[model samples]
Target chain A: MRKGDELPPLEIPITRTLIVAGAIASRDYQDVHHDPELARQKGSPDIFMNILTTNGLVGRYITDHFGPRTVLRKVAIRLGAPNYPGDTMVLTGTIEALEDTSATVRIVGTNGIGNHVTGTVTFSMRDAE
Target chain B: MGDDPDTPPPRPDFYDPDDSAARPKPHGANDSTAPGPRDPDAVAARPQSGDTGGPAVRPLAGDTDHQTPRPHAHHPPDDLLTRLKAYEGHPAAVAGVGKDPVNLPMIRHWCEALGDANPVYTGPGAVAPPTMLQAWTMGGLTGHTGRSSAYDELLALLDESGCTSVVATDCEQEYLQPLRPGDRITFDTVIESVSDRKTTKLGTGHFVTTRTDVRVGETLVGTHRFRILKYAPAQRKKPPARPQRPRPVVNRDNAGFWEGVEQHRLLLQRCTSCATLRFPWLPGCAHCGGPDWDTVEASGEGTVHSYVVMHHPPFPAFDPPYAVVLVELAEGVRMISNVVGTPYDKVRIGMPVRLVFRTYDGDLTLPVFRAAAEEAAV
Candidate 1:
């Protein structure tokens, strides 16, 4: 149980389309993000999302919950494990501190297998009517 | 608490387009109106030409569809070849070139100071690391060691000319042979071109591209291209605040000092035998290898010995324009600290400063130094 927590568990379906899109969007041309054989050569279990992709996905998940009105003030993240295609990532956030107009949320992203990325996000919100 | 907690509100009209406060125009609505062409809001709302539209597109300002012209797409092969050949015989120039080969001992000492033990550098089997070459080249170890290399001398020249902002924007290098210890390499650099660009916060400056060629005897080893942006003074944006890190607890070997620092005191270890003060919080003094020492509180006042305004944040807890300073304190103990409370342009060698403690997350305290006087004599 955490303070200022309202959103439910967000399950982001990981797909090859999303992985490829994320890689191309970040200008990361690493084949491991798209080609399975290249990823295998690099000692990965399979084609996996890159750091930038993981960051984008996690940012997107939080923003979707808060809606377009919220602005992301800061995000600090550390990559723990890899997120491969076909693994659904569940992004969970716990409000660590709450102010009159803002809140600091500790967001942890994990797949069914294990945790992938852990980070703290500080965001500002409009007053509740 | 007389008001009802829960109440049903009146239903709003569905087709009320005249409600003045219902909706505001989209963001960037007043960006521009004298348009030869315009993108409709509906089209703009849709993600264009990339994936993960939220964070990615927001940072990039240029045309998304502007295709990067191929290396030689527009120019004829002969013309490209001619330009390449013209550059072949021309001497190579590097930006921020130094006078000596980075004082090898100094580099090793700096790495050790950071408490990093990456074997590729310190191990017996370690070859010249790729990064070491870049560092060495900047410290001016390319060729002649008698005077500051052409690039170092150029910076001095530029500084004397009153150029306020000097920034290294792009660095591209091709490594042919791995550099090894004891390899004396000679390098010559030439200014290829300098062009004016739009003014940034640092100031209105020009982009200078220098080509550097490294040679071992008559054999060509490698080439480096360096681009630096120099600007004049202007209003600078305040860097974003860094996230907090948990403080590490101090014990017997370091206890009296951690407690003092928590109380905003600058404490140093003084040797009992030689009366020498050691920095970086080591176990013993480097001068006499004396284990017996006494705790001394520093006044936290010093003069800047040398400094660098890092545009690139090296750690997660720092931002750009952060000055990494080497201060010669009154006690003669030069310690490394981040200089705050002054414009980046105002920092200079021999500038007086006083220590200030910045508490982070209510636990960790960082001893940052700030200018001591009202106005820094530029």
Candidate 2:
């Protein structure tokens, strides 16, 4: 991977199953991600994706693009808008800089509302063939 | 303006010690002025001689009875934030070591729990999920006993300031290498930073961040940054509404478990081929990969394998300072549930428990385990 190379956008359909499954998988028991009514009570329109889910998705995106050999060094993302069910989140990233064996990738995940997540991911490419 | 015309003026005898005309004498039997036994430990001696039971019901370690004890105090100490900040860069966990090697069984359990069907996580030559980074570092059922003293001191200070409740805010992780089976991991964590005083909907407290570096042998493999808010639970103007427990997500693979629960039967999935029982319900057996399975109704007998007293980020549905346990069933599968009918701290490993179906809210019934010791005593 070289600086300025943009990763292909990954489109994921947000489903209730995905929201709840992701929340459960991450060991996060927060209700806003699983219960629509609870989410509403907490000032959201519907059940939304959790930060861990977003992080997992981002990890999947980078690993898929960089191949199995690419090792994730860091994933630092801050959540913004909520990714509610029935919406599609498209994650895209561009290589921000390149070091000897690693590259800094700036990623932004957007949905119908706006940017749901934005952050930087560092990957070590030493094991790449 | 000094005194209203309708108000009676202060009596001349108001300041007199013998002023029975101005004030009634103390009359309660406990208010007697005659000196009784001056024993300092009098109150402590009042309990029955056989009350070993008192300690059995003592509050769990992390139980912060915030709302009942200090309902009127909303803000933490003014210097608490500063003192917490002084702990920045201090060791939170040291000489931390992973008890079990990064193995397939744990990775498999994680995938099953999350309903993750990632092909790479299974079969031979499989790698553990990257997100399993923290799981590998967890202290398991008994807990991580390698926590440093400074971390305990900081928590004690936070507790003293009435910022006794805490909830994990978020975590950021970076993986440098893929973890495979047999890879032993070790980690060391340091206090990263402490945020200034802030008021969240939960309450007013500081956000503490700890950074952990995970290594395999000598190679640094990952870095995990976890943040938690230690705050006083917010006081409601009116009695707070009891929140409903979030319903479990039942999918095709695990629907049988919930169905069994509805029938008041605690079912453990037993692989028909290997006869190995498993829990949290799985479609296939981890031991033999047998897709066909049957259910075994548990005898409702088990022992607490491990437990934690949840006392942070108080949730509406859950009472803080409650003990959540990992129980090893008599049939040999482990499941996570709340330990009831005993003090959170008193729920110890190896304590016997019996399953009971409880209606959490008016609507939902869950299989909860109560301490068998308490049952026998009653």
Candidate 3:
């Protein structure tokens, strides 16, 4: 695999429930993350996912695709635009390099409005029975 | 300029509105004489105001039209987001050290077993050994037995597949002071870098390097650079043989000096009576044999009083071509310590030296001397 090769799309729909759930799980109490009114008061368009939540979700998507036998060696990701509720974020991973038993994958997540997060993930895989 | 009294000063045309203050004075004006409200034509030429307060509002004919454009809040860019995300995963694993806690009692036991008798460790000043402070704070050894630290938990999550083993190898520490008991130190550990290495068994495994910074409150106590190798099981190999070095025996009189060496401080015994400075610090003065002696802190800056290059040391830990020097400090004191940071051939008597802390076995802190440039005369 090399750079610019697009992988299969992993769709995760953004919702108020998921945003709140993630905020709770990560213990992020910043009101702009889960309260739309507070977010607007803070001059944002709407409530959005916290950076940590976005990171955890992106990792979850990659690990899910790679399966349990795959070991996630490393992941580097950056959060971009705010992911608003009701937006469907499409998570995509492209194989950047495959050497020996290890592969480097570039994962990107984008809503229809704009890109939300992009990262590079490395994994070592074993043959499945 | 005189006009008839009945002329009423030509009845300034207030109704004609050329001077009427109520007829929409130039929008930003506090008085009619000021420039009329900013030109409507110019306002129309600019971008339209959005509901989210995109454009600054111009005051209209009434006060109700006042509006202020709110600025957008700055959010982290995609690149920072990506780096932070990548940091969430565990670092590659190395060998030699595991994630088990180095408990406080265990550390105390290690210090006692090693025979360190500093009051800072045993008596009223019984502070935790400075280097051992990191293990007590962040090594998952404090408080609970089975619980892992924040970094350790992340490492466990990364290695859930169990394909690799994590090991810690290198550590660099700078001691500002000793850590007394009951001081809770916090740690921020990050996966510095990761790479792949050749596999001896089957396929390639991962090599992870982590930089764990340990701090007490806001003061940085030490930094540990841990290198781990994660790979499958390999064939059994023979253990490497150990090298030996001359071990200097320590008596009660010289014990404090060696302890100072282990603490990375240069300590010397100064006689209060004859003012004689002695090395290998003894409890009694060498000149007067007076028992009135006190510890003096050495600046660790000195001149090489004498030297030797050992090429025939048969110990596994003692490598050949290393210089051991007797340095005469500025205070008229002398000490025997290894000279580092200079070529073996460059070493000479009277060469200026500075002290440095060296870590052996990832635990013992040893103070050694290295060459330093002489200061220019003022």
Best by TM-score: 2
Q: For residues B292-371, could you state the per-residue lDDT of candidate 3 as single tens digits?
A: 88788888778899999887533457656778888888887676778877777789998888778877665556777767
lDDT of 2 by residue, A48-89 (tens): 887667777887787778766656777776555567989999
Label model 1 with its docking quality class: incorrect
Q: Write the per-residue lDDT of candidate 2 for residues B187-303, one digit (tens) a residue.
A: 988777666656665566667888899999899988999877677665655544555779889899988888888989998889999999888787789999999998889999999
Model 3: residues >4 Å from true position, as ranges? A1-5, A126-129, B1-186, B189-378
For each of the candidates, the C-alpha root-mean-square deviation to the true structure, in angstroms, is 25.3, 23.3, 32.1
Fnat value of model 1: 0.00
Candidate 2: Cα lDDT at B205: 65
The C-alpha TM-scores of every prediction are: 0.29, 0.48, 0.29
Better of 1 and 2 by DockQ: 2
lDDT of each residue in B1-378, candidate 1, tens digit only: 111212211111111112223222122111111111122332233333133221112212233234333333333422222222122112234232333443445335433322224443445544443323344444321343422232343344345444544544444444455455556667766655544233443355445666666665566556666656554544334443345564666767787677888888988999998988887577788999998898789988789999988874235555456778999888888888777878777889998998889886776787888898843553
Judge the docking of candidate 3 as incorrect, acceptable, medium or high. incorrect
